[model samples]
Target chain A: MNPLRPIGAAFLRFLEATGRLSEFTAVAVSHCVRPPFYFRLLLRQMIEIGYYSLPVVGLTTLFTGMVLALQSYTGFSRFSAQGALPYVVVLSMTRELAPVLAGLMVAGRIGAAMAAEIGTMRVTEQIDALATLSTNPHKYLIAPRLIAGLTMLPLLVLVGDVIGVFGGYVISIYKLGFNPGIYLKSTWQHLEFMDVFSGVVKAAVFGFIVALMGCYNGYHSRGGAQGVGAATTNAVVSASIMILISNYIITELFFAK
Target chain B: MSAPSNPVPKIRIRNLCKRFGSNVVLDGVDLDIATGESVVVIGGSGSGKSVLLKCILGLLEPDDGIIEVDGLSAIGLGAGEREAVNRKFGMLFQSAALFDSLKVWENVAFGLIQGGRMDRIQAREIAFAKLADVGLKAEVGELWPAELSGGMKKRVGLARAIATTPEIVFFDEPTTGLDPIMSDVINDLIAKCVRELGATALSITHDMASARKISDRIAMLYKGRIVWNGPTAEIDRSGNDYVDQFIHGRAEGPIRMEVRAP
Candidate 1:
């Protein structure tokens, strides 16, 4: 009857569940190497997870870029450093803001949806149906989503970089009375391919983590409706946390020098 | 072990035991299903009937057992080997479990196109034909799973299960959530499909009417073990108290429900 007993039990259960997940992942990797690869399903998931996610990422990046430009200009102008506006804007957008914002946006959108969809399938026994029909659900479901995440995230990051830079350009030239040519020149001169590449690479890794967490939580979900909801919540929260953690690690790796 | 000489049994399980934690679901269970035979396993809710089927299908691993299909050991098969074993199976899920994102025909044609690597046009043609076989119109094939009625969804599920004309077919609780008339219709369709395909079938259901209608042999699962098994015609005279208590839906019996104080 102790109150701490339930909390202790829950903690133990969580550890046990994590252990199971590690085992499932090992099995999934092994299955992936064996053939009868479902290329069509992978292509279909790529379209759903990647192509469909472009618009949302693009919109978020554009608005974010514009706002960052405005905010940086406001902050820098107070110190009479308005000349450094373009350098700061492009550097910030490409190196940190674009990938992080894009990762978070996708975590909310694609991560939640993937979890819910896979969770519903688990409850409905569609995943079981796949197994009974000689189809490996991991191969058919997880592999495609993973491939899509790895492939599409880089593209989404590229799009985000462009939109974010363009947003800064608009705010600088129209709102802040800067010369468009000079602004563009300063932005290009300050930004390096390595910065863009690193951000894109982070986006890809973040995307993979998001989809993996979503699919993993949902695929192993039990009970029913409430379980599906829990899976979705866990997927979004976990993916967001992983994104933040990985972002820091990648930053150190890329900019340590 | 000596392999059967002439016709191979489609599925065979020996000394199967499954325990979830300390709670046992299947205990020393053994079953054999011959080619072209229809076997129905019947039991009360929580009777481990589904667990037995899942073990045979290799979806759940048994704690200690051997499961063979077409003389191939299914228990420890690798992924490629498991896929080969699974290619011989078609299953109708209890909830239909249709993919909402796909059109009806696409769902039906999923295995044929995706697993079998058949062309889309050919798969669609086969899917439409299978739909027609289940008395569903061609137009139903174009609609999504969400758009279909419960009965229609079950029919579409039936079509998808049989899309590849698998050698063995499993029906899990085929009549659980349907009107009596609709259940009868599904049973009839099941019977017809089994006959036409000459496929071995293993179905689990609590519906005695369905068991009687579709099965040549009936097995009754009780307390993690099959207590009674024989030809379907002998079910009425089995004279087993557990079977009687179950078939009549009586509250007073050896089988007791676990009631806990809240």
Candidate 2:
């Protein structure tokens, strides 16, 4: 095998995929703006993407906050810096952990579900049926999911932020023998509006990325059951990686001084 | 089955071609369906009958061709124009393609509610009426498609196909998976629905019995082209070796099954 040839082919495939993705995204985003909103479908997707995911996201963020406080306390106490634990916990939860962790979790749950569901629909010719019925699949299927993802994730992350901070508070006050009043006061004092706002903004973008990847991979999936399996894997894996990549990018946008 | 003098075909396909990479599905195929006519394209699996059906419905873009439906050119239609052309069509997929998420009635009423701009109550009533015409009960309409039997699913699909009384209907291998008795039942219902609506019908099937039952005319596709086309009554005597081989299900004729290399 020629080294350059494989690299060239892989590069060409990447470019081709990027072009297809751009086209799909353009059409889907355009459909999101148009009329015939299909409000009922949007509502259903909201429940699926947001409401049903509350418990899981809540648990993930809560546990993460607890772990963060524990780790920070252990690290800070060695340098007589235990006073900074609450500040660090709250800042991390609001600015980075809440959005990133929650985004990764939703990417796993919603992204995989969307891919598997739509991939099965593709294999079954339901997408073709939708087209034949004078319905644009982008409008009917992908647009609703995108809207739900965009709107609901910020809501999820907001809840995640609150739960995570509360988790840190619980661990700091009860488990670490810190005063509850001091922990609460310290957590609130340094958690700025910008920190939370940037995370929420990141949530919106991450949500869009998850749904977009799910819809894109599922929409383009072919072959059959194995193909659907591949799409599901690709959706979750890609959404998670994109969330990580974009988290850093958005953080730089927000906090790079 | 001869065309009436000066008849304008409701659906006209000329020099239609579609390809996937190196594999050609439809290659310069030509056919016409007269108004209110039932034409079944018969071919083995992978012979591209489904691709031909998809091209006519505007579901698959042909690499090249002219498809005129009801005197409107179908090729290269903008999204709006494509939707306009698609509104004239109703398709029944092999698995009935029922929206398992929707109730039986919602599946039946989809086109009316979505395409015809009809309200739910009105659409449901029409849906029920169509369901009844296809021998389904109102109670059955309340149930989800998953709750229905295979035969019931096909009936619901037929109800959906005629829900809006489309100008043309497509059945994609309508009886492929059903048992013999159920297949016959579906074939009968499809014929009745197409006849009652006076809609032009283009169906793809490999099942000869179903084809003969539902179609007035049969077109045989082989190697991405229409090999022979004539009335169903004359299919047995078409005298073309390929048609004779296909219709008789004999392996000893001119058609050779391509066994892929190991």
Candidate 3:
């Protein structure tokens, strides 16, 4: 009986924390519409959270596409179905790998950074300062981030999709001895607009989740340095989990027969 | 001071209560701040001083209370109303919380340009003027917050707080982490600014020197309630043991440290 007590306490804590998060999100959304937009601050956040994250997302997608081609080639060649390599690579990149990998990467990079920056601000009473100055922190801080996340994620995914397809193209033509034209044609034929659209949409949602979790944890962080570090970790973990869960739900919506 | 006969307190709290789960931070706290008076709330760390300030600012909702500013109830106000109320106040944070992304002048002019909807040129002019009021040069307005020293940043924060020329100002731990000389400088600047603007000021600090220097009235917060409140000159004769021990920074007093066996 005593052994289960700690588990029950943890569950209750989880419920409390979840309720707090919901309240925070509600406040953030309300603040989004108010006036006093800080366009300059928003542009800076976009550059940092979106543009600077391109290299890592790009590199990850490229390698992922290349590996998919190599593995699919090996498996299909056993059945004399090596010709399906182009379709497999393009489908995987456009449908799942591109968005998921890009999301995970940005979740680690931008999510942690947002949490640290905001958490530090919280500990130092900067958020309070904003309120006292009559500036809504949600409008000034979270809205710009939410807008940037929504806009930048799709852009990042589009870039990743392009790089991923190029990765497959290079591997197939040079290493696998496939006709470049035929491989390209097969990829174009097999991929649908829905697939690309769904992936990009998922990127937007993932970006929102990442930014939301980072901001929520940061704004509510307590204590000091330890609290900030904990918030950063929580942002990454929560963003990653939400991305995976949302990906499944979106897939179910789009692909359920 | 002659009574203005307009019975509205500058800031009023009646039966204000705040609780974080089972921990009560403010318990049935009632206070009145008159117009153009500088009141300092002195308390030990973790004594709910910040919580009281936050409640007044509407940053934290009091579980049970009525907080009124200039005769308007701030609690449960709609977004527009709350914003209108906030526009009448300014704040200087403990660490001079300037926005790192903005130039110094932009930070000061943030409320003017955004909330007041003034044009950029006009806002910048007023910002430069306010910066000058805080003893900062016009060129210093071009620098980022990260590029400024602690004292300089505090001055910029002061400039930002007064940029809109609000009727009330709140200073949270104004001298918590400053050198004595810098602390004195900030104290003097605060006195000068409040006098010049004729603004009502509410400040929270553990620094006795700061309290003595800048306060017209001093209120001691202990255990989520004000134990002693009177004119600054009466602090020495507060005749309360808690006040006596806290003012002298004595360890062996009625205030017990929550130190557990290690």
Candidate 4:
């Protein structure tokens, strides 16, 4: 009944969970690098995580860029700095908004699906069946998804970057009465390669985080339907939080003086 | 020489123990199955029956035990060796546990294509043959597991279990939710498949009818220990109170159900 005992017990539980997650991640990564890779499974997961996610990532970033342009215009006009509109739109879309927003959106869609599917498999004993059938669940189930996330998120974000900047361009030229050629020129002038590179790097890390959380939570899920539901919720929440946290760390590493 | 004085058992388990925190599940379980023998461990729900099967299957490690398959120790084997050992094993889960993402044929062919590395076309043919063996039509193999009836799913699961032609097959509560006629059908099919393959068979169930039908021998698990072991023909006369209570489905017995008033 000691108050300090409860805190110590909770701390121990946290440390145990962190250790288990780290081991799971290490094993998953090791399997990814090992032989007998399931190319078909990898292709299927890529299509699921990347290609299927295009429309949502596209629409989200496009609208984000549009709203960002309007907000930047309102703020810049106060100081008579409206010429910075294109620069702001392009830089923000490439460096931060596109990757983060696409990440969060994809985390909601793909992360939840992976967790629910794997968790259901766990609860149903299909994962144990996989083991009995001489297939390693980590290799057969987890590694492909992990590989897909690492590769596909950056690609999705890159597409998002272009679409988002285009959204801004459309808004500035049509709504703000700016010349199209001038706006395009200003966007190109302000965008450094490092800006896009850093974002793509962040996107890759975010993708890995999303997939890792999904697989880790799902793989360890026990009990039944409610356990799977909990796993799915945890997957999305953890992935979203990790994305935001890693985004800042990566941004700081790239941009900090 | 005809044979060694003591031929090694296909599967030999001794002093098996497992505990989840303070709740002990399996407590010193001992069993031996000769090659090509069919043995069923009968127990009520939550009696660590499934845990016993999982431990032998290497899905769950027992805190203390010796599990030997074909005279070789199975505990703590390396991944490659474990996979090699497990390749000879197939299982039919209580729920059938089909991969919902895959078609029925794919589910059946999974062990073949994944474990045996047999090409899909070859595996599909073998899958169809196994499905036919279980009294399923070839057309049934194309449908999703979700589209299947409860009985059909069990049949498909039986088909998957026998598809690899495994040396040992484990069935986990094979007839749990099926109707009587369907249950008997699955039971007969299980017996037929195990006999045809000449495989050692192990199953865990509370279904006395299923135990009698498919098992050559029956072992009754009570309080995580094998309370009785004998031929299925002798189960009715075992003279064990637990067996008597279990077989008769009686409420009054030495074994109490822990039911509390709400």
Runs in model 3 lying further than 4 Å from the true structure: A1-4, A30-38, B1-6, B238-262
Tell me each candidate's TM-score: 0.92, 0.97, 0.92, 0.98
What tens digits encode model 4's per-residue C-alpha lDDT throughout B152-234? 99999999998999999999999999999999999999988888888889999999999999888899888899999998899
Q: What is the C-alpha lDDT profile of model 4 across A1-257, one tens digit per residue?
A: 88899899999999999999999999999999998999999999999999999999999999999999999999999999999999999899999999999899989999999999999999999999899999999999999999999999999999999999999988998999999999999999988999999999999999999999999999989899999999999999999999999998999999999
Error of 1 at A152 (Å): 1.5
User: Which model scores highest in DockQ?
Assistant: 4
Q: Of models 2 and 4, which has the larger lDDT?
A: 4
lDDT of 3 by residue, A133-204 (tens): 666778888988887887798889999999998998898999999999999999999989998999999999
| Clashing pairs in model 2, backbone N/Cα/C closer than 3 A | none
Best by lDDT: 4
Q: What lDDT score belongs to each candidate, Candidate 1 first? A: 0.87, 0.90, 0.89, 0.93
For residue B240, give model 4's deviation from the true position in Å.
1.8
| Model 1 DockQ (Cα-based) | 0.72
Residue B214 of model 4: what lDDT? 88
- For every candidate, C-alpha RMSD to the true structure in Å: 3.2, 1.6, 2.5, 1.8
For residue A244, give model 2's deviation from the true position in Å: 0.5
DockQ of each: 0.72, 0.77, 0.59, 0.90
Give the CAPRI rating of model 1. Answer: medium
How accurate locally is residue A164 in candidate 4, as Cα lDDT from 0 to 100? Answer: 99
lDDT of 3 by residue, B105-145 (tens): 99999889878889999999999999999899999999999
